[model samples]
Target: NSLAQFVFGFTESGRFGAARQTKNSLVINMSWGVGLGMVLDDKIFRGHNGFAGEFSHISLFANGRLCACGKQGCLETEASGWALTRMVKEKILEGSSSILVEKMNGKGEIQMEDVIKAANNDDVLAIELIAKIGDNIGRGIALLINIFNPELVILGGSLAQTGEYIRLPIKSAINKYSLSLVNNDTQLKLSQLGKRAGIIGACLLVRKRLLSLS
Candidate 1:
């Protein structure tokens, strides 16, 4: 799904959108986990076992919280949609007030979308959570920027919909963590194709594959 998303950014913007003609870019899909897809020199990068772009599991903390991948302190522990939901639930359990408490009604579940909606509606707790997670995610991206120094970094998926609530923190963190000279070359933007990025990229991938076989 993530690799397909990179296809969307690589082709859509580079060919038709404002970032046209770009040949090197990266896509970070912020859903259940932080999914990454890289395009360098106009080609997708699949690592040795085709398991590349697992940006979420890049263990950031030595003694931090445990992640679903059974690792402690992974970036996903703080930055992904699952992380956002987890943080909200933890805060609520600790008596942190937010509209989410009312939305959950003390029994039902609170989802990622609910938090995003709350943030967009100016819920203080939700906004704070997003800012925190965005900062962590940006730290991870900063490492990538310093290394790959791609032309663009496209952020997509559910969490990114919070708009500047998320983007600003990520941008700030990137500035703080990455080298000015390196990050200066990168253009970070939310996916214009929005939620449909993965689906469209999948379609484009299939077409490309079939055409190659022909």
Candidate 2:
């Protein structure tokens, strides 16, 4: 309880606060890569080896893209911001037409922010690419919801700034794949923390460990 209070206290006091009104919550940070954290029964649930929340490496595709984990088809292969950039670059290489192509102007590289900016400007390719990434993300999240059954799922990291662009597909996937009993009660929310959630979480984690040692 003290650990939970401490973690939450720091998080709440920081720039981004809790996105849900429950004791049980799962926070999935999706940026260049994916990371996951959970609070259960009002306490942080770090698995026995202190690596329980490694949600990014969960296999989502068999024979899918190779992940940095030296595995094929991990969730990070298709759902991370890096994944989106990869997808966009692939499309551009294949001679796909889009405003992004003009923006890139032979740069031969695309940042996630570039894609997001194009999407916001209503670039067709950018929107489609983001939607595809969102779909992949939603599929992974559907599994997590079924497994964890948490009351809330908070999405953080740079990609979450796209807001409804990503959220809609995620919701659609959850609605289609997750059981109504679980999906109905699980509220999906964008992290109020934006990109600072990870830093705040790290500080809280250190505090929790020091407290536990004492």
Candidate 3:
């Protein structure tokens, strides 16, 4: 699809410049959700059913929290924005110390933006929770590195806005778990495209599809 293709193209053009500059590169667009997109020989690869990049559903824990997909311990359960909110809510319910308590304003819901805001404000609990999410994401990325050995892993989505607070932990986890030889070469990057990625990708896809039909 163009969404996947545009993401791949944007990453290649913005970061790597030339496709040949890297051995192999993978573009992962993870926001409130997660997905893995690949650029192989400068082309987007969608497996047989066009469902190749369902990285979010990868089973990470055998008996972990339930996922919307009706599976337990899926990567999304631990690493996505929803997961972050869940963690924060759990902590708040436990009476953990956090600025989020007041930030909630009596609302019984926690949003990912609230977590990001709290983390940016140097809230220890927020920072720690985000770090945990990053670590879980890193573990998932490590598996991808082992399997694909791509030269790059680009992170996008609302959570990527937290920058180093999240990236650092993910890098640390990757370094600790991933094979040094393979992990060392892979670069983890935040999306420069930001929120525009989905729009850009969707537009690109439509244009391409129409062009193909012509």
Candidate 4:
């Protein structure tokens, strides 16, 4: 709740303070772990206000789905960090007979790391769960492709460490949803920054502010 509130406040203030630069301004952002994207040329491309590049919360489905944003079938409901943890927790709870269960010692309190470990070992339950997760994630990205027509998409986060286990599904989704010409122009990539992207991006923000004061 605190983070969400902070993000909302920051966005509100930034929007409130922007100098309305109608030039060839650029905003390169790494967020949502759906990947990083850049905004160039005209248009904020973030929708109305700062919500354009908001990958954290979007309608993944139109049905009655519940989201942290208190919305139904939001993309974050099934694709965000919170969503990943929730799925891992639920799979462990299902007692679906996985090595994951053994790793938890029947306590059923597993995290994304546990899921990844179990998946590495090729645990039946872990494999299936990860695949399901990859599929859900792919579906989410597919939604973005349909909407944004972005030039590139980068995968990063603790979860993206899973490598092809995750990217494959996202690629599959892109294949299925986007047209060949558009999708081909769109390069789906893994983050070169590794796990440091968010931290680095934040630091870059502060550094820029300092430079501007000079």
Candidate 2: how large is its RMSD?
4.4
Tens-digit lDDT string for candidate 2 (47-162): 78656666788998875678998999998898889989888888988999888887667765688999988888888888888888888888888888888888888877778888
Off by over 4 Å in 2: 1-16, 103-105, 205-214
Evaluate all candidate structures by whole-model CA lDDT and list the values in order. Answer: 0.81, 0.76, 0.77, 0.55
Q: Name model 4 segments beyond 4 Å from true.
A: 1-37, 41-51, 88-95, 103-105
So what's the TM-score on candidate 2?
A: 0.85
**Which segments of model 3 are wrong by more than 4 Å?**
1-23
**Candidate closest to the true structure, highest TM-score:** 1
Candidate 3, residue 202: lDDT: 60
Which lDDT tens digits does candidate 1 get at residues 33-107?
A: 788777778777777776777898899867578888788999988888888898999999899999999866668
Greater-TM-score candidate between 3 and 4: 3
Clashing pairs in 1: none
Per-candidate alpha-carbon RMSD to the true structure: 2.6, 4.4, 3.0, 6.7
Superposition-based RMSD of candidate 1 using all C-alpha atoms, in angstroms: 2.6
Q: Which is the leading candidate under lDDT? A: 1
Whichever of 2 and 3 has more TM-score, that candidate is 3
Better of 1 and 4 by TM-score: 1
Q: Clashing residue pairs, candidate 4?
A: 46-52, 47-52, 65-72, 65-73
Q: For model 2, name the residue pairs that clash.
A: none
lDDT of 1: 0.81
Residue-level error in angstroms, candidate 4, position 145:
2.8
